[model samples]
Target: MNKQQKIIIISIVALTALLAWVVLKPVQPSDTATTTTPHEAASEHAHDHSYDHSYDHAQAGDTHDDEDVVTLSDAQAASAGIVLDMVKPAHIFTMLTLPGEIRFNQDRTAHIVPRVDGIVEAVTVDLGQQVKKGQVLAVLASTGVSELRSDALAAQKRLSMAKTIYAREKELWEDKISAEQDYLQAQQDLQEAEIAAQNTTQKLHALGAGTSAKGGLNRYELRAPFDGMIVERHLSLGESVQANANVMTLADLSSVWAEIVVSAKDLGTVKVGSSVTVKASAFESQSSGVVSYVGSLLGEQTRTATARVTLPNPDLAWRPGLFVNVEIVAGEANVPMAVTTEALQTVEDREVVFVQTAEGFRAMPVKTGRSDGKMVEIVEGLQAGAAYVTKGSFTLKSELGKSAAEHTH
Candidate 1:
């Protein structure tokens, strides 16, 4: 072989043997493992062990002084609707709130009726129309009224004739120009006519037909008995109504009754002449009234007694059927320091108020006295002139809870 050919063969064999040796070598566990140098390994160990020693120390002392404190800026407080008010001396009332409804005052209300049977001829007043006392309400044509008026007229004629006859008889008796028996008979006749005339005239007057009918004898004018509003009407033109029929209803709304239900237990709380404050549920209105009536017997179904408070309804503001709350001032107290009821919160079994501080607010524990559902008397743990949250105190309570949880974690 040539020298060049010999060298080529030797090189090819060396390369093939080297590849075979590598394929035959065994794989050790160290080869399968991920490679990391001593520096890289130290870096990893340090990373896994790294932690905030200061945070660990802080967590050990979890009960921080500001733990119950909620920090917020002025803008944040305003946005969250956090309202603050000063604690001050105030009066607290112990009240009993009972549901009630406004009703028409029965004493001032009347059911108007045509006194005699009649056919309606003219209706001057209508439903909801205001009327004055003695104003004509309606006109009716009644044959009954006409008969009474006719009897009255006939009685008047007879009375005139009897007067003349009696005068002549009296003169004759005095002059001794007539027999005594004849004069006595004329006097008896005159006396009987006078009695009949008086009776018929009164009967006509009782029917509200008056002493005389100018144009129509059957015409009857029904007049209002008081100044009021017509609440109901049943008679119309050409309608026939009976004497006792409830043809109309008039109500004097100058006064109204606030009727309340009192349970058996509360009967002792309410009494006649006790003053109460009434608040309307349908509108923002408040009024004061005195208890006027209390039913003696309880209702069969409800087992409650009905009580009434009289309220003067000037301007017709206290309308009938409006739901109301009658707040009876059962007791009152004057406290040196008080806060609104909403300012109090139950936190960790403690009654607390979020008192304003230079660093936001802190939940201040309080000892409370009398509470009237509106304001509570802070007997201890808070001083007057200190500002505290009045509204939106719940938000401060939540923030305090969160702070506690974070410290625990």
Candidate 2:
């Protein structure tokens, strides 16, 4: 019994000691915590790297912006036909462009008419036919012409009779073979006949009819007054034309008129003797002329004044009724910086000119002043001697727009 009790007591005390040691021992961290901390740190490093990558990308985008440029190889430029020019001083004219129409020069235009009533026997000219001065346009059978010739012939015969009688009487009186009254009467008759003849000749001259040697007294000829192109024809064969009937219209096409209707505001700008450029709309012909007339009266219906430019159309290119543009140069100004008008482009509501740079051409905005169609005055944002695109600047503008769109994206 003693041995058994001692063994049992020893076992119980050993079990209690094991339990106390187990309860009093300090706690240690788990392997899962170590593994989780490392995973979190790796995630944080990856996030920081991603942020750095985005920052670098933003910096690169800023660099691109600082140099808003376009680069084209020499071959590409040549193929595009890009022309470059340097800024220089030039005279730019301020011009006022107005709509106009080509018209017959009224000063050199004529409406041919038969002075006496007649029947048109033949029409020698047609519409659009060119004729020289004194060229017969048509022939007529005129009764009035016949009467004029008859009167002239009668007067000539009477003058011949009076001359013979006067000669005989003068000879008799000088020889003292005739009375003084008879000689005086003969002299008075001769004077009367001369007066009648002169009156008849003047009347025939006024009628534009000369005594016909061919005995066709009624023959009347309508002739051209000047060298001109026939623009209109009214008389035909066998047509009866009255006195003062306009048979044909002839216009000197060598010179034409550019009739411009100017507004009241622009009346002062367009004055007589001012130089003008006339451009035909139907064709690519331009001529320079002087303003010959500026009407004092404005049209009541149109409320505009008529201005005329006498253009020499030696080639007959400026036909009547053709539309035209009249550019009146008001004045000229000397500018320090100027460029071709083709070089100027409107971008973002600003006038821009592509300037040559080390890398490429950069679109630069500019302020402009006076301008003719050929050249324009660059008031600001451009310096003399700076190279710029002249002929093909529009292509650069399109390129710039594309670049801007890409940037926005």
Candidate 3:
């Protein structure tokens, strides 16, 4: 309870009062105010702007999907060289093309046979040699021809004698130099001789032999019946050939036949007298012909019917055994809308044609029908007079592919 104790107590009391004043003091407004920096203010403003812009872009992205529009400037379009066409009505013919073979016209072809058995003395023509009608193809030595010609010669001599006897008998009868019975007998003999001679002459004529004074009796000439080419020759010098044996095959190559192997399904369409176009495979020449024949029965092995078309082969271009394609016009159809075949394309396993739009081109799905190789009938998804891309539609397809890829990403 001294002065030191009182000093310590005063210090403690002062400290406690100071702490209490600090704890109990009211919070007054700061003299140095809290202020934001320019960089911080800019950062907050940028965040708000980014949020609003993202929302606006999200709204715009939805429009992009609904409008699958491709925009190309005039310069770009010109550079791409896009070709546009308008759909129109056209005649689209359904055609059936069949494979065929060129063959000889059997109607004008001949298998020459010797009528009488003989040895082939000479063959004047070779295979593939062209000859005119009445041209001798070969000379044959035949005993039968010889006998016929001998008979004709004897008949000629007898006929001359008969004429002499008939004149003498008539003169005798008129002058009364011989008895009436004797003259009548001579007249009868002359008549009988004349009849026998005529009979022999007719036999020779039937055998195509004559009493020619120049050649030997056994000589027989084989001549061409018509102007034709010798496609086959089985005759040789001094070779014996039997009667009715085919010695030569002559063909009048002025005309040929297109043997078309038509499937059974096409039997109803391919008819006789219908026109068809035949295209040769070896060359670029095409010929038109009429279907001359259509077999009623199908071949057992081939399961196809045979149809024939006769074509004139003046130039001999339609050679036998040459392969050909015959396009028969089955029928024709008039369609309301048609487009060029070049405009058609396959996209996503769908047949599509690029239809022109105000903004750009759109790949429009379509259903196609009869096609005549040049024009195609549009069955669905297109209207007449609508603009479509014909030549350069592939470019638009590529552009569409790029857009789809971007959307997928």
Give one digit per residue, the lDDT tens place, for model 1 in 260-366: 99998898988898889999998889999999999999999999999999999888999899999998878898999999999999999999999998877989999
Off by over 4 Å in 1: 1-86, 339-375, 379-381, 387-409
| RMSD of each candidate relative to the true structure | 9.7, 5.8, 8.5
Which 10 successive residues of model 3 have the least lDDT summed? Answer: 63-72
lDDT of each: 0.90, 0.89, 0.86
Q: Which one wins by TM-score: 1 or 3?
A: 1
Is 1 or 2 the stronger prediction by lDDT? 1
Tens digit of lDDT per residue, candidate 3, span 1-409?
9999999999999999999999998866673355678998899899999999999999888766434455667787678777889999998888899999999999999998888889988999999999999898998898988887777778778778877877887898899897788778777877887888888778766655566735788888888889989999998999999878999999999999999998999998899999899999888999999999999988899899999999999989899999999999888989899999989988778898888787677778899999977899999989889998898777767777788788778
Ranking by TM-score: 2, 1, 3
After TM-score superposition, what is the CA distance of residue 116 in candidate 2 from its true location, in Å? 0.9
The alpha-carbon deviation from the true structure for residue 121 of candidate 3, after best TM-score superposition, in angstroms, is 2.7
lDDT of 1 at 76: 88
As a TM-score, model 1 comes out at: 0.69
Residue 80's lDDT within candidate 3 is: 77
Local lDDT at 295 for model 3: 94
